[model samples]
Target: MNVWREDLLTRLSAAHSATEVFSVIEREGKALGFDHLAYGVRFRYPLSNPRIVLLNNYPEQWQTLYAERGYVKIDPIVMRGMVSQIPIVWSEHYSRASNTFWEEARQFGIAHGWSQSATDCRGLQSLVSFVRGAEYLGSAELTANGARLSFLAHAGHEYMCHQLARDHHAQDSGELTTREIEVLRWTAEGKTAGEISILMGISDRTVNFHAANAMAKLNCANKTATAVKAAILGLLD
Candidate 1:
């Protein structure tokens, strides 16, 4: 196993807090020789802003451009990943003509080695992306390392979930029914109540009910805050 992978596993095993786990993930990205690592949580509703965590190597200029340009709205990789339960290699998605991020990414010397894996934890969608430089992550090289990257990405998500759970283990909020947890998880992912209702094969009103109950238990001001607090408490995972 790669030393970075081993280190990641060790840190995750020992992590008692979300901060500690995220710190380890940052270090793991650095150790893997990537330009940066980003983990973001996208909410279902447009009104709810997404939450982001940057690891290392995202330039301020690039960050500004990415956000100011509304790139996320048109980012095909993100859109696809949100609906997928499995991992996706960035290189494969880059081939699509509709992938808006590709042009901008190439200009940034971003490697083709990028890959993302997503998990739905209590309605919040968490995605972790590993990005490298163009020279470092050529097509051929990416093909060779794809499996390993997938493993690492999945491990990273699992680590986050474990840490989140540990953080909330001692808290005594009102017990949320399984359906409520499911609704909150999707709500965190930026899903509309109607969309969630369709996905769960339930009524929109039922979806709203679960969300309302979850928010009350979490004592959050709104859906976005509730999602964030749920993540912090490890309730989503």
Candidate 2:
């Protein structure tokens, strides 16, 4: 890797909080010639109600307008990220579905942009987008920086995932042991105590014991709820 990429990854890995991570991204993004930067993450475990986090240096009014209009739900770039890992350059031709959104983004001096996405083993999906007003991000530019941009997207996602998971665990008020997590993960797959015991090579009573402890730690009323809670908290990941 180049010095620029190595240094940026080092800084990102050392970042302990969301703000610190955002700062690292902003600095590195500007160094790469972007005028604005945005990073967004979404969790995929809950299936019922997923969690999303966004960090951006966009204009305040644009941010407010985007949120107020629920643009996240309809952003074509985001939709593409869900199914493919391809890097995308912003253009009205490809963003016909969200023409108005793209137009408004241009009004905020976001005329040229590119985005790439990364998904982790924990089912956390992250997208990094860089935008500028004057310079167009053409094929030549993408060819020059594509590898580094993809790396940034992945590393940033991993760092942010670790920080967010730590914070969420703290807020959950308890921690699960390795055995507890293992048992809960299997349980989430509809495994009963007997099945879990066979899979884990433990007694059924032991399986129940672990399940009971996990339920208590998670403050769940039953095993079903415990499994769901664990999945939602990304423990299954």
Candidate 3:
């Protein structure tokens, strides 16, 4: 393994907060020649939500659209990773699914070449996505780097979860079910009900129901406010 990969493993083992793990992933993306990186968690805990911290270089417009349109639902790459605990390349997902959103993603400079991995951190799961400015990668290159990417994803999730667990401030009031937590976390990450529904394999109505329940428990007026409260309560970082 590369020195950076080893370093990431060590960091994951030692990280005491989500912010610290995010930093390591951001740094790794820059070192690995990728243009962008994002890690999002789906779990019952308030802090275990689909929070994404950019590594720089991703276009502002793309980010805005991604959040505004709730693209996570239609993002096959993310969906595929969530269901499986394995490293994957973007092209593999594209080959299996077709959606209008994928075309839209291309227009936003997010298509073509990418790789991703899924990690199960304790009972929570997350995906780490990486994008490059190309259409494809050779089998040889993919073979050589696949394991490394998996390592990064595993370490990143471990580090983030460890940090969230250790930081007392990260805890929130009222425990939630796994599905409810997943919905709330994605909502806090700015995903729309429709988007969350798609990502979680549920209906839009179901997504809204979960959000409403979460809002009531959190004593918030709206989704936006609920998200803010989640952040303040250290449910997200």
Model 3's TM-score against the true structure: 0.59
Candidate 2 Cα misplacement greater than 4 A, ranges: 92-95, 177-186, 189-213, 219-221, 231-237
Error of 1 at 218 (Å): 3.5
What tens digits encode model 2's per-residue C-alpha lDDT throughout 1-237? 689777887888788897898788778778889989888888764467777878889999999999999987888877787788888777733544567987888899877878888887777788888888878777888888878877777777788788877775564667788888889988888898899999999999988898899888877789988888888776777
Query: What overall lDDT, based on C-alpha atoms, would model 2 receive against the true structure?
Result: 0.81
What is candidate 1's CA lDDT for residue 76?
A: 62
Which structure among the candidates has the greatest TM-score?
2
lDDT of 3: 0.67
Return the lDDT, model 2, position 135.
83
* Alpha-carbon TM-score of each model against the true structure: 0.57, 0.82, 0.59
Worst 10 residues of 1 by lDDT: 42-51
Q: Model 3: runs farther than 4 Å from truth?
A: 2-5, 11-17, 46-57, 95-99, 113-121, 165-237
Model 3, 59: alpha-carbon shift in Å?
Answer: 2.5
Residue-by-residue lDDT tens digits, candidate 1, 52-154 = 4443356677777888888877766677777785656666666663445677666675545455656554444567777766544566756666666676677
RMSD of each: 9.3, 3.4, 12.6
Question: lDDT, candidate 3, residue 45?
Answer: 40
36-113 per-residue lDDT for model 3 (tens digits): 777666554444464443333467887787779887677777777767765666777775555766776677667655
For candidate 1, report its TM-score.
0.57
Better of 1 and 3 by TM-score: 3
Give candidate 2's error at residue 16 in angstroms.
1.0
Q: Which candidate would rank higher by lDDT, 1 or 2?
A: 2
